[model samples]
Target: MTEGPDITFVLGTRPEIIKLAPVIRECEDRSLTRSIIHTGQHYDESLDLVFFDQLALPEPTHHLEVGSSTHGRQTGEMIIRIEEILRRERPDTLLVQGDTNSVLAGAIAASKLDIDLGHVEAGLRSDDRTMPEETNRVLTDHASDYLFAPTEQSRARLRSERIPDERIYVTGNTIVDAVEQNRTLAAQRSAVLAEYDLVPGRYCLLTAHRAETIDDEQRFGDLLTGVGRVASHLEREVVYPIHPRAAKSLEAFDLDVPDGIRIVEPQNYLDFLSLEDAASLVLTDSGGVQEEACILGVPSVTLRESTERPETIDVGANRLVGTDPAAIVEGADEMIDRDGEWTNPFGNGTAATQILDTITGAERREVSPK
Candidate 1:
């Protein structure tokens, strides 16, 4: 069974790699020739290269060193680079994951060049246009040829936007696949628990990198104080993997990180998986972390006012506590003390195979679109 070289996956950040790794393995198993292109969006060695190595994904066929820039500038630069790569690779379909500048850029390049675009983690919407990710998701959705929605809610969102229902497939969620697979491996091999001097359920996992929270000095100060407040109130250690931008913002604002809140550099995907698995509760402004925590059945308090993945809240898997110290303290206290049992509204962890099956079937049908 010889499959054609028909897909090129676009990955830039650690989250994209985590969610896409299973799909890449599935493609390899089915012998569907695939190429991966890395846009150096998050170019740090620890964050980017470590994921490729740890996940055992093939070294990217191409790397477009489009480092950090303004949304318009970064995406615009990626469009040019991706278009160049598309010309050289000439794959039948271009695959992108999540809603990032990279995803938007890849979609725009692929669609304009008449290459079929497959968007994994589609149909997610926070309805907060002020956030760049919302804009990326909307633009990428309309441009994609195949939309792999992670849940029923995402599918409903696509239909409302007039995207053809026929083009959408509820392929569970690829992130859950990553979570399930990695947790198993990490449980067996991770020493992070010992290194951090932690006991299970005794600490909170914290990550906040969103511009909305960090870009505002007052809000950022509240976040630091709020996490400190939670740690102080609960007498729990708060393990934070500080994003580079977030660390700089802290220094810029002259906000002193208090004791008992352990601030370390950003972790690679594996370290994060292990850390999250061991946490009593999770706190973040990340969309992906919200779902990851929910699937792991760890209660999560989102620092944002709203989330694109409303299913988390719907299933009581997560809550939005915003940036207020009092609210964060209260939310953390309640979630930490509660019993952990919430139905994962995301999926049962078989998303990657389903996505590939649907895509392969679609490729066959295109021969006779009737």
Candidate 2:
């Protein structure tokens, strides 16, 4: 008997790895042949190691080493490398996630080559093309043959764009699955809390690394200063598991981590999840983290002007605090006082199984034409 064609999972940055790990495991358990292709857009070995080790994901089957470059150059190199891999593997389908250059590259290459494309974290939009991720997410949604939206808001965004409802499914979010599966592991095994001499629910977890937030000197300074001021005012430690880019930007801006603010290197995924679970509130510019915080039932202050996941805001799970330090401090205090009463709007954390079921069922129907 012949084996099935492999399903290729494309991932690059840290968020993609966290969000897609569960689906990879699902495919593995089903004995469906699969390949995880890393595009190297993140260009950080530690970033890759943290997710692989913490999530227990299989080492990637293919690494393109596309690395950091201009947006166009990075996306172009990924297109060429991924196209080459797809040609060689000739997989039944390519799975990409979220709104990143790597996702766009994989979708473009796969669609052009006539391979079925699956988009996890699909149907998300900020309606702001100035944010490259918004453009990436929109384009990938349209190009994909299967769209696994994490929420009804995500689904409606795709519908507003005239994408067929049949092509879309509300599959919740795999990050929630990762968070749920690992929260216990994190509580049991994590030393991250100890390393900081920290206690859960006593501090704010902060992470800001969006290019828009970091590229502008004033904007980035506002983030650091705002977070610093917020920490000072709350009389609470603001733990920043700093992204490499965010760290570099802070250095470039000569922004000092004012007294009482803890700036640390990126924590491994499990450790970070544990921290998120314990935090009094979350302050971040990451779209995925916003959703993760929601799933963990924590209030979040998004440090961006706009968010792709406004559903969190709609449900009172997150507030857009922009880059203003005063607003940041105010928002953080409001959330702290409010004490996160809102329920999680993301899901009950079964996203991976739903996503896999949707894609494989579609493939079966396409092949077996009823």
> Compared to the true structure, candidate 2 yields what TM-score?
0.95
Compared with the true structure, what per-residue lDDT tens digits does model 1 show for residues 1-370?
3565488998898889888999998888888988989998996768786888888778988888888888888999999989998998788889999999999999989988857888998999988889889999899988887888989999999999988777888888988888888888888777788887889888998999999999899998898899999888888889999988888898898898876699977877777888997798898999989988888878889999889989988888788889998999988877886556877877778888887777777433342121
lDDT of 2 by residue, 1-370 (tens): 1255468999898889988888888887888889889998888788875678767888999888888999999999999999998998899889999999999999999988868898998877777779988889888988888888888988888889888777888888888888888888888998888888888788989988888888899898888889888888988899988889888887887877777678888888888888898888899998888988887888889998888888888888889989898899889888776566677777778888887776666433342210
Give the Å shift of residue 206 in candidate 2: 1.0
Clashing pairs in 2: none
Model 1 stretches with alpha carbons more than 4 Å out: 362-370
Query: How many clashing residue pairs are found in candidate 2?
Result: 0
Best by lDDT: 1
Best by TM-score: 1
